[model samples]
Target: MEIKAIITGCTGMVGEGVLHECLQHPDVKEILVINRKPCGITHPKLKEIIHNNFYDLLPVATQLHGYNAGYFCLGVSSVGMKEDAYAHVTYDLTMEVANTLAALNPEMTFCYVSGSGTDSTGRGRSMWARVKGKTENGLLKLPFRAVFMFRPAYMHPTKGMQHTQKYYKTLSWMYPFFRKFFPQYVSTLAELGQAMINVTIYGYPKKVLEVKDIVAAAAITGK
Candidate 1:
């Protein structure tokens, strides 16, 4: 089967990593990227759509209708954002995309890049965690054929750096040491991306997948 996908946050580290893997997969026929700025990469199977705001999706909703999968990686750090601003990014923006996509392609598989320690309970004291939890819950409510919430911790990436990437870089350097002792809490960006693609291509047994599960799945898929 040829898989058609839509990827948001294509310029981000994890997003770029996943995009690379998508291009390498024989099953993938096309990848549509929606972002605020250009990714500057060109490929016959790739389409880049630039938009200033996510709300602009309303006008192009039809173009997003036929994708087989959606990898939603767009997110922001909650450290500096006000509560409303953080919620807008974590919950509002996510729900907007998921709802729109669900309406357009009810059969699409949706995968989200979520973090560990996310409080699925809406009443959690941690604001960001709660917002992410709410977003995850709301996305699950949508009528997609498959919906998965991926919770990864200390993701080790081979390239790219943002403020958080530096921290992960430190972890990546020490991964060999940690893997020998505590292998449960860490996962590579390659594994994370591959695991997500596998879940979308195959079928995930659960709605939420933790770090250990993701690593195991990635290994089985030889990714």
Candidate 2:
């Protein structure tokens, strides 16, 4: 089955990486990216829609049909923000978009980029984890063909990508050490992207995937 995917957060690092992989992969036939601003990319397989408001996607609902995959990579850091404020974006915004996709494409396979240490119980002390858990829980309840939550702790940025975080320059050198020592907590951005794509095409045994699971999924051959 060919993949016609709607990818969110392309202007960000994770989304951009996933988009890059989809562009090169043979099974991904089409990609639609919705962003508040231009991601500055152009390709025959890519269609970009610049919509300022994610909360209300009614304006572009007509154009979002027929896709079979949804990669929800949009998110925000909870630093210095109150619980309610963080949850508004982390949980509310995500659910709104996921619901929109679930309605438009009932057969869509949704992949969400959560993080390591996410509290599935929703009662964790970390505010961000709690909000993410709520988001994951909410997504699983959506009426889609499948849903997978990816929890990656530290992802080494793909070389030559423009959206890499500024701090990676200082910390990226530690990736080898982490990969050898704390293997469960570290993976490359390429692995995360490939894992999402692979899981969309070939289902995994679990709904929630951690760094090790992501690594294992990335190695799954599509051939």
Per-model lDDT: 0.83, 0.94
In model 2, the Cα lDDT at residue 184 comes to 86
lDDT of 2 by residue, 21-127 (tens): 99988999999999999999999999999999999999999999999999999988888999999999889999999999999999999999999999989888998
Q: Write the per-residue lDDT of candidate 1 for residues 82-179, one digit (tens) a residue.
A: 87889987799899888889888888999999888888987888888898898899998999989999888777785643323666765677888776
Per-residue lDDT value at 42 in model 2: 96
lDDT, model 1, position 120: 96
Best by TM-score: 2
lDDT computed for candidate 1: 0.83
What RMSD does model 1 have?
2.2
Off by over 4 Å in 2: none
Which residue pairs overlap in candidate 1's backbone? Answer: none
